[model samples]
Target: MAHIVGGIFTSHVPAIGGAIARGLQEDPYWKPFFDGFHPIHRWLAAARPDVAVLFYNDHGLNFFLDTMPTFAVGAAAEYHNADEGWGLPVMKPFPGAEALSWHIIEHLVASEFDITTCQKMAVDHALTVPLALSWPGADNRPVRIVPIALNTVQHPLPSPSRCLALGRAVHDALASWPGAERIVIFGTGGLSHQLDGERAGFINKDYDRFCLDHLGPEPEALVAHSAVDIVELAGSQGIEILNWIAARGALGPDVREVSRNYHIPISNTAAATMLLETPATLSKAA
Candidate 1:
């Protein structure tokens, strides 16, 4: 049966795409963030998952404000990147795992999650930047992708508890699939940074540190805060943590942190990278 290999979580700051375009990995300001990926590359090298089930939020590329779905899944054969007017170069398309995407769609619906299924979706930096960070260089991405976009862009957004449950349902779906593929979960976006409002350019490092510390062992700790509470503390755009929370749910319980990097002010966000997985013995024993 198909099994989850691990989950990779990171901030999908737009400037990351620009940094890549300008070859700024070693630049003093970008160095700390870029260096975080070196260990992620090493982990991916060792884990070798065949497919990635990505959890991210769309940024007006595929879904606009008026037509956004709370949750959407991609069933396309390939996903292309487009210009979001952010001046970031378009990334090469990522091949999709269509069958697996459909299977996940079916399972989510059966579990009562009401997810929108997209046959053609244009991925933006949120999805592409993480792939670039995990597998740098041309033709380097070795896994098929299954994109799952959450509604972080709009208000009346799903709660942290709900997203967590959605992820758990996805975990169950992967477990029931009869394929032999090894899957990795990608959760993109945010530690703590706000883009607009009176608190514009706001970031809460202490809260971010609390989240990073408990995401694995005590995710419910995060769920205790209301959506309004998150906005008050982490900023408006910081609601992107919903993506990370959902990805954590898909990982199930007892995950070991392989490596983590946290740095502040990565283009208006507190950038973070964390690689988590179930213990090898536990995975095998299951």
Candidate 2:
């Protein structure tokens, strides 16, 4: 049986992927952080999991506020990349692993996760763009995907504890599977930056670090934090740390950081990536 490798966190800021591609690392503002994620490239290479259960929230593209589900898993054969104002660069399209997906969905519900599954739906740029940027090429090849989309666009989104519970259920579901040997779970979203209103430019380095601290090996702290508290600190609509908490909760305690990177530019968002490994060594911390 394969081990449930664990989770990763990253920002899906569109423009930044292009910036990094254009050698933004040379900019004094971004270099140290780019250096921070370089280790991820290395970690990814070594782990080489058979599948990646990716979690990403759409920016009102795929799941609109009209009829939103708390969480949806893609059981589609192929996902089209739609433009979100800016035309997304076409990369390889990922064909989800239906077998694994069905198993996960079945077990998640049995565990009371209640995830929505889509047989066919066009995957928006929110997921593909960041995934492509993170791992160029090799779609559904080295790492088969089971795409999970969260409904963070709508207000009164799943409560922090609810999201965390779902994550714990996800871990249980994955562990129950007897076939898959190596799996990588990813939770993609924000860390303290707002994109609208007068508070748009806010960036909280302290909060970001605090989140990473509590996420790994101790998510109870975040569970104790109120939604209002997170919104106030991270911004009104920036309370998506719940997504990260979900991913962390699934991984449970006894985790170690493989890599961490943080960067903030003119855009009203902070980009960060954290890689957690299960049964990780004590020295892996940054």
Candidate 3:
């Protein structure tokens, strides 16, 4: 049986890591939350899961303004980070776990969950940038990535319930796969913030805290709320909460919050990280 090593809930604000690296955490606004990840180096060393099922949403980079699938999976042997006109350097190539990815794809499609699979696609910086920065130990080493991207950049995206259901589908698919030793399920995106238009730079620490609370103890409550309402609280582009539903699914009912950090200095971004595991995870490590 496979167990979720932990869940990391964080913002992809791009410059945050550089800020931390430059000791900008002492800059009054970012110090607390940035310092929170200090022990993370040790944690990653300990858990050291074989792979991470990265759930992220494309920002008009891969899908574009064209037709976008509600849910897409990357089963490619490798994913390249191409230019996204964002001025950031291209991300290093990621080694995707194609074997498990194909297994999950086959299982999910057979279970009637429509999934768009990509092989020859270039992964946008939105998906690859933040990921590459997180692994301090990963000095261009290829770590297997199982990307489960959502069509969140567009309107009429899948409802909250649908995302939650998709999480279960992911959980079941991985659990049913044989000989999978350890896995980490990552839900990347927001707590509450908005980017775009004049209304940009909106930061709602209150809403972000509510998200962490509800995501941990009462996910159903959060899911029951409509996307429109959440959009109002989380901002127009705040629909990224769907990524959190996948984290909830990975954590299950008996989820534990190892640590949580919420900050609003970056204006349009909320930074957070959470660790989740089952009782069986310790034995798996043993």
**Candidate 3, which segments miss by more than 4 Å at Cα?**
17-29, 137-142, 283-286
lDDT of 3 by residue, 1-286 (tens): 6666766666666566445345465788777666666565556678877787888888766787578889998889988777666555665677888888898899889889888998755676445644644574324553477888887777777888888888878888887878555777778777677778776877667777777887877788778777887788887767788888865775556665766666666645776766555556656667
Give the true-structure RMSD of model 2: 3.0
Candidate 1 clash pair list: none
Candidate 2 lDDT over residue span 2-58, tens digit each: 576656787766665555456575687666555666677677777667777877787
Reference-based TM-score, model 3: 0.90
Per-residue lDDT over 161-265 for candidate 1, one digit per residue giving the tens place of the 0 to 100 score = 999999999999998999999899999999898888888899999999888999888989989987778988899999999999999999877798878899988
Per-prediction backbone clash count: 0, 1, 2
TM-score of 2: 0.89
**Looking at model 3, which ten-residue stretch has the lowest summed lDDT?**
133-142
Better of 1 and 2 by TM-score: 1
On TM-score, the candidate that comes out on top is 1
**Residue 94 displacement (Å), model 1:** 0.8
| Model 1 residue 195 lDDT score | 88
The deviation in Å at residue 90 for candidate 3 is 1.5
Each model's lDDT comes to 0.90, 0.72, 0.72
